[model samples]
Target: MIVVISGLIFYFVIRRIRKQIDEMAEVLEDIKNGNGNRRILSETHEIVAPLAYEMNDIITSYENRLSAFRETEENNRQLMTSLSHDVRTPLTTLIGYLDAAQKGIVTGRDKDDYIETARRKAHDLKDYIDVLFDWFKLNSDEFAITMNQVEAVELTRDILIDWIPIFEDKQIDYSIDIPEQPFRVNLDSDAYLRILNNLIQNVISHSHADKIGISLSKQNDKIAILVRDNGIGIGKEDLKHIFERLYKCDKGRSEKGSGLGLSIAYQLVEKMHGSITAESEQGRGTVFQVLFPLAD
Candidate 1:
């Protein structure tokens, strides 16, 4: 009688184990069929509980990575579409003006004007192409950054000096306050210059602001640089995506160029161990602040 009882207990345990295996197989099959949300569950006392929890974690991680990849792929597609439109428009204009000028469609000052327009368009196209190249290079694996310790206050002041003439030419008022004190930072000078240039260029191109202010100061162990403009400010929705590649605000800003300037700036700043942010209110203007860690 005892032998028979032991046999029955062993048989029941084997049957329960078989049922759990079958259930796990079905759940795994469903997951394999693209139901990433599916998860296997088991009681804490069950032998397979740990395996089930581990599988769930693995599936969640994989799904998250896949979702991110899909998002990046979609963004690249949109960028290509934007590239097509932005390139073709200026290119077509440039060719038409050149052709008309060559065919003598207008004479004297009119011919000169056509040639001038063609020249300007050619330059504009070159600028757009340059931005495109930068965007591609930045996204590629080979982009390199050289970092060195430098007195950033003097360097920043020197950079702004070159922009003074441009501001006057654009009829934009400027107030720059860079403390004569020096602060050390590890940065790529060329990259830093480009970052500042892109921010200022964005203001000039998109912000219809007539007044601009630049200030540099040290905050704790970080250096802060601010670019403020009294321009037609960006909307709340658009401000959130200003640093995303190929993102343009059509309602509040001019839809011009490749829309990669601010994105490139953001990436460059990050590569240099810095951060960039912006704040704006409709018709109240916008301010861009960049921060970098101060080097000892």
Candidate 2:
């Protein structure tokens, strides 16, 4: 009788194991058929429970990555389409202006005006292309960053000195507050400068603010730089996506930008082991804060 009981128990265990194996196989087949959401669910008391949990975690991870990849692909496609349209429009106008000037369609002041318009458009085109190149280089694997320890306050002051003339020319009131104490930081100077320049450029181009303030200070072991503009503040919805590549806040097609400035700045900050954030209220103002670890 005891032999018979043992035989029955063994038989039941084998059947249970087989059933679990079949279930797992079906789940895998579903996944293979493109149902990444499929997962194995097993009771904790079962011997296969641990394996099922692990497999489920793997599937979840795979699905998340796949979703992200698909989103990125879609974004790239949109960027290409937008860039083509943006490039063609200005390019066509530029050619028309130049052609008219050459053909003597208009003379004297009219010709000069056409030439000037063409020149401005040409500069805009160059700016767009430059932004495109920067974005492409930043996204690629081979982009190099040279790190070094430098005095942060002096570096910032030197950089802003050049911008003072531009600010004055624009008639935009500006202030710079850099403490006399020198603070050192490990950073790629070129990248850091580019990051700051991009932020300032964004403000000049987009934010129609009359007042701009830049301040530098040290907190604990971090250095903080703030660029604040009292201009047309960013909308709540647009603020969330400002750092996404090719995302533009201004809705109209007439708005001229490659929409990669903030994205490139964000990436450069990361490359230099720093962080950047933007805060804004509609019609109130916008402030961008960047932080880096202070070099000992």
Candidate 3:
């Protein structure tokens, strides 16, 4: 009778343990199916509590990592698409010019014009490649800005002076509204120049506007620079994505840029402890505003 009682007790304990194991197996199966809702809810905390917590943590971490990877892959796809389009445009132009020259369709001044167009396309391609390389360097955390205290007004004036010839050639009128007094900021001079150059070139190439307005002002501990153009203006949809890598707007405006200019400018601004914003209406105009914190 004593032996029989012991056997019965052992059988009951084994059955209970088997049931708990089966429940855990089912929960793990659910998790393997990407259902993270189910968790081990063992009544006795001594055996499975730590295991459940660890499993949940693993699931959460995997989900987060997957999400990050998807985002990065999407960005890379967009970049590649934009790059292909940008490169193809110039290549097409170059081929067309070369074909015309070879077929004797272009001669004298027309031939010279064709050659110039091909050369310009080549230069544009080079510039686009350079911008892409810069963007990649920035993204890879390989680029560093050497910061220094500089007068903001002087910097703006010098950049404007350098671009005056291009403005004149494009038949675009520009107004500069900057104070003669010094407003200083701690920033990378070369980076700042590149930012300005990219912004101005973007306006010239993409805006196609007759008038450009630039204003620099200081308020409290910040300096604000505004670049406005009475151009075709950006669409609401496109405005939201202007800073995204290689994102372009409509076909007409799309052909104008490699789409890296604004992105690089955005990155450079952040590096300088500044922020940039854009505002536009479909037909009226577009404005880009940049704010930089003044040196303490």
User: Top TM-score: which candidate number?
Assistant: 1
Ranking by TM-score: 1, 2, 3
Tens digits of per-residue lDDT for model 1, 1-296: 99999999989878877888898889889978988888877888877788878888988898899899999899889989998999998899989988888998888899899999899889878878888888889888899999999899999999999999999988999999999899999999989998998999899989999999999999999999999999999999999999988888979688777789999999999999999999999999999999999997
TM-score of each: 0.89, 0.88, 0.80
Off by over 4 Å in 1: 1-10
Off by over 4 Å in 3: 1-51, 102-105
| Overall lDDT per candidate, in order of appearance | 0.91, 0.90, 0.85
1 against 3, candidate with superior TM-score:
1
Worst 10 residues of 3 by lDDT: 40-49
lDDT (Cα, 0-100) at 169 in candidate 1: 86
Q: With candidate 3 superimposed using the best TM-score fit, by how many Å does residue 185's alpha carbon deviate from the native?
A: 1.0
Over 58-162, each residue of candidate 3 has an lDDT whose tens digit, in order, gives 777877887888998998888888888878877998999989988999899999999888888888888888888888888885678899999989988998897
Please report how far candidate 3 places residue 40 from its true position, in Å: 6.4
Name the lDDT value of residue 253 in candidate 1.
83
Compared with the true structure, model 3 gives a TM-score of 0.80
